[model samples]
Target: MTLVNTMEYNKDDLLDKVQEDAENLFRSGTYFCSEAVLQTINELLGKPYDENIVKLASGFPIGMGKAQCLCGAVSGGQMGLGIVYGRVEGEPMKDKMFDVSKKLHDYIIDEYKSTCCRVITRKWQGDDFKSPERKEHCITITGMVARWVANELIEDNKIQVGR
Candidate 1:
């Protein structure tokens, strides 16, 4: 129900808007960046994967459960890529899945200069983890990650784009 330049948005636009909203809502809770992205992407993809899969992303936040390793956003984006192109047991789509994952990881690293949550957080909001500013920073990043996945879906013709 958003309007840009006084023009009503289509279904695709609405989907994007809701995903962004969901990201913020989820982040306000104990959910981390990876969980936020996974949940949002699941809904945006029309729930292609089971909602229960969000649990799989739980341990990825704060760099694999506060380990300060890989960025949770990057991990979630890779999961999203897998959700779209991954194969079930005995399937053979690893190469394709890896390719899309690499694209997402490269994009995030290139844009943010690293794939660690600590580095990303420091670069964006310093070391304050409890301030409203920090919350906003994470929310913005979550939205950006969701949008990037949506764009990739559109580019691959996996989803329709709004005109």
Candidate 2:
């Protein structure tokens, strides 16, 4: 698996499906951070859940409705992990879920020092929420979080890139 550490990922359909695709959705102004993450992963997984699944991620945007605690992208990515690694109620817990979930959190913390939405976007708090700079910053993180999750799925052999 070509992990993201190499900064090398296939520029194939997987890129379109995960990172760039989600970025576009967020840039379109309809989908927010968490929604874009869930939407892109849903598409990549062949829509295991229906369109309404996106609502699960809606509350996470702007750090749980602008509470600015957790990073919405990270929260959304965790939901993506749940979709992949979570088991049925009667089944045993998947061991990999905790590990992967923490890894996702680590990814954000390692890069930005904290996964809190306020911390990550601290520089842009004074700007208008719809300002291009603010939007671009969130958009970039949205793409990065999606790409990181996609890379994890690929490395763990959970999902194929193109599929």
Candidate 3:
């Protein structure tokens, strides 16, 4: 049996599936941006981790409950990283977790030009919570983050690429 890694699978197809799943979740309107991203990752991983983790991500949407802080998608991606690499005891994996988090954060910033929800949603939502544009913007962010996080997980061997 071969263990999967970055070079062992079709990375693009995996990313595409992540993106598609996230978009479907977004359109379902059953989850917030952050919840959607994290939930999708959980689903793709066959729920190896506690499925209840999805509830933990509920408060992250709309910039941490509309406080306009960190982008929910970014937060969700970091949370997904934690699901795979987070240490439950000792401090051995601490550095790895932080490193992966920073990488995910950088990826978000590079793609979205910012990691703040207020900034990214400014044009789409401004001060209007019910703006229709917010959904599309959040959906795009959710898909992008899901794909990036999945790639990171696969490359790090936290998730088997072909599984």
Note the Cα lDDT for every prediction shown: 0.72, 0.82, 0.79
- Name the candidate that leads on TM-score: 2
Pairs of residues at least 3 apart in sequence or in different chains that clash in candidate 3: none
In candidate 1 the C-alpha lDDT for residue 18 amounts to: 47
> What TM-score, to 2 decimals, does candidate 1 have?
0.80
Residue 50: error of model 1 in Å? 2.9
lDDT per residue as tens, model 1, 57-89? 988877888787897777877788788898889
Instruction: Give candidate 3 regions above 4 Å deviation.
Output: 1-9, 125-127
Worst 10-residue lDDT window for candidate 2 reads 1-10
Name the better of 1 and 2 by TM-score. Answer: 2
The 10-residue segment with the lowest total lDDT in model 3: 1-10
Badly placed stretches (over 4 Å) of model 1 are 1-19, 123-128
Higher-scoring candidate on lDDT, 2 or 3: 2
